[model samples]
Target: MQLDRLVARTMSRFAKGGLASLRPRQAPAEATAPLAATGPDRPRGSGSWANEWVGTKAAVERAKSLARPGRKRKSGKAAADSIPEGTIRTKPLMSARGVKLHNWISDRLEAEAPTCTLHACVSLGAFLSADTAHEGHDPLAGLVADLLIVDETGQPIAALIRENVADPSRHLLMLDALLDADLPIIDLPAKPTLSMLWGEIAETLPGA
Candidate 1:
């Protein structure tokens, strides 16, 4: 029993000493010393520490960049090329050809068509007729004719207008509407006359 006790004591001491010896020791002060005050390219320590520091800094910068907000997304309804509101002029918006046609019609009504009178002041831009002009009506709506001809009695004589060659679809639609309405349509040429217009209207009339 005494021999077993001595062996146990020796074993206990050996076990404690063995475990202490197996544990890793703290690094020397010199081994873990700070690098010299030098540029990154000239690091004093083994390159592993400098490389780890550089990698950490790079990761932090990358995280910052990722967290930054990006540009806001544009709305679906927003158009890059759309004209600003109120910027579009309601009147005097007609093309040069439209203006010339308006003047010609005005002159003819004043000189030859004494029974007919100018319906409204001619403007270059599209305008809604009293029949169509109402609340919720789009002022910038497409037009069927450049001018509406009316008699002194305020009867709609015809739609005296010109075709817009630039927009074939719009021109066709306008022409179709006039035909469906059974209204007289006088297509103005590059240069139109009062007599030619009157002749067309007379043909459409019942007892001309």
Candidate 2:
């Protein structure tokens, strides 16, 4: 497949210089914090890192810089007609259901066997995102991952995304563009139960 030069550039950059370390082998700063315990009734913020589907404000900005599209659509519709491309307006774009779901995922991972292929297993709430950064021959840019997983070197291992609550067209566009770049994307329902999420993830679980 003729990948967009920009996408190639991103892959190359990630492979070469670690532009922005998304998820390395070591635990995230938050993961170092102690968890009170994993249970059915754990409070939201007790002993757990904040559930940031995106990230910190500074982190969000950094991610945006990397994912920003190279050029605007030339159609005469102006900015109004363009995709918002904004990942966040509020600090953390999470839902009540999402909070529980994310927490459960975090807890469950910690309870699982070691050497999990999904780095999220080691570092809960980890995320990965990619799109054309440079002005290469790619057609789309500013792609974002609600939840993505990567290896020690920031290479995309897998993409586990719940259905996007924003522009579906743009989300689909991003998925298509990512597929061209040879990244895999998995879709779950907007409100997947913990069991449902785990079931979906089981497919990607390669080794025991």
Candidate 3:
């Protein structure tokens, strides 16, 4: 009976030792201390730092590009150059009396006279300097012509007046002002067809 009891006790101790050997051993607290100490104050991981640096560099390059000079202006010779050699830009002529005055004088001239060029909105004062400078006699003082027809050599030909049916008085005033400035006026018909307007322009030309 005593021998059997000793064998049973030894077997139980061997079984418990085998179970403990099978279980995984926990790492020491000192071994995990370095991982726990890593926080915001510490340097970031390699991948995180590289990504942040790349983002910052891209932003700086973009800022530098914007600050650089030699930027093209939208309204001057640069804008004109961007258009094709023969294409004409057109816009609506604003009027107060609900009459839609189309101001494609430049466009039409460009299309018809490929050799002859036309300039839009040239100041009357540029040609009528003497009249404009005369005191209390502002002939072109608050008046603007639609276009200046010029030959390819840039010779001033005539001043174009696009008529608005709703404002006959204004048209007459502009016509008188242009005449006083000693500039030939090409008065277009109110709601004129392209063919009709072109015919009038052809007649107004010196040799046409």
Candidate 4:
């Protein structure tokens, strides 16, 4: 009985503060961990610029919301993406050569046994809330995904980015924000073969 009681008391002390003592050492990592990324971790080259575009953009939106709380933004992104209301599309909504790559991805989704969903030109602003909130949250305002793969419940599971890498100013920012938002990002080149696209998509999915 004495040994059991002592063990319980020692455990109580450890539970009370032992965890907290370790937190200070982990503070910096924790500060950055809020930028949690999920899905395919692509090899962004060494030259990828580390900018605070997400926080800056978020701050701007927050300020706008505060100044005009009564004002509301419209849903014109759908029109920009050329997506029709009330329909599930097989291929991504695009008007360029990227159609081939987008089509390949849609085909892949259709073949999945459990059957994930495919969405084209998904507006990050529509589903993400970081725009009206604080810094560090990915404010994906005015950003769109080339394609989004969602689970059966309409929750985004993966994203495909078809970007012009020449413009890192926007592309890199989008990449970082998507990572911070905890969404998987797949980089599909404009002109990839069936095997090339498969490799890119497969790398991000589980087990590769």
**After superposition on all CA atoms, what RMSD does each candidate show versus the true structure?**
33.8, 16.7, 31.5, 21.4
**Where in model 2 is the C-alpha error above 4 Å?**
1-90, 113-133, 136-140, 206-208
| Model 3 clashing residue pairs (backbone) | none
For TM-score, candidate 1 versus 4, the one ahead is: 4
Error of 1 at 81 (Å): 22
Please write out the lDDT profile of model 2 over residues 1-208, one tens digit for every residue: 1123334545575567542343423336563534444788755543223322123334545544544456445664433313433333655456667566666665665566223433222211133233443545334445556555554455665676655567888767767666766766667577666676776655554453
Residue-by-residue lDDT tens digits, candidate 4, 1-208: 3333334554575577653332222223322223334557632322111122233334545554544534554742221224334354676357667665566677776775245767788787765557545665555766778787777666777788878577767788788778888988877765656777676666655444
Clashing pairs in 2: 67-142
Instruction: Report the lDDT tens digits of candidate 1 across residue range 42-149.
Output: 635344443443443455455445434462445544323255434656555566876665676667667667676544333312322434446765333565566677
Count of steric clashes across candidates, in order:
1, 1, 0, 0
Best by TM-score: 4
lDDT of each: 0.56, 0.50, 0.56, 0.59
Clash count, predicted structure 3: 0
- Candidate 1: residue 107 Cα off by (Å): 3.6
- TM-scores of all candidate predictions against the true structure: 0.40, 0.43, 0.41, 0.47
Give the Cα-based TM-score of candidate 1 against the true structure: 0.40
Once fitted onto the true fold, the runs of candidate 4 whose alpha carbons sit more than 4 angstroms away are 1-93, 131-138, 165-167, 203-208
lDDT of 4: 0.59
Sorted by TM-score (best first), the order is 4, 2, 3, 1
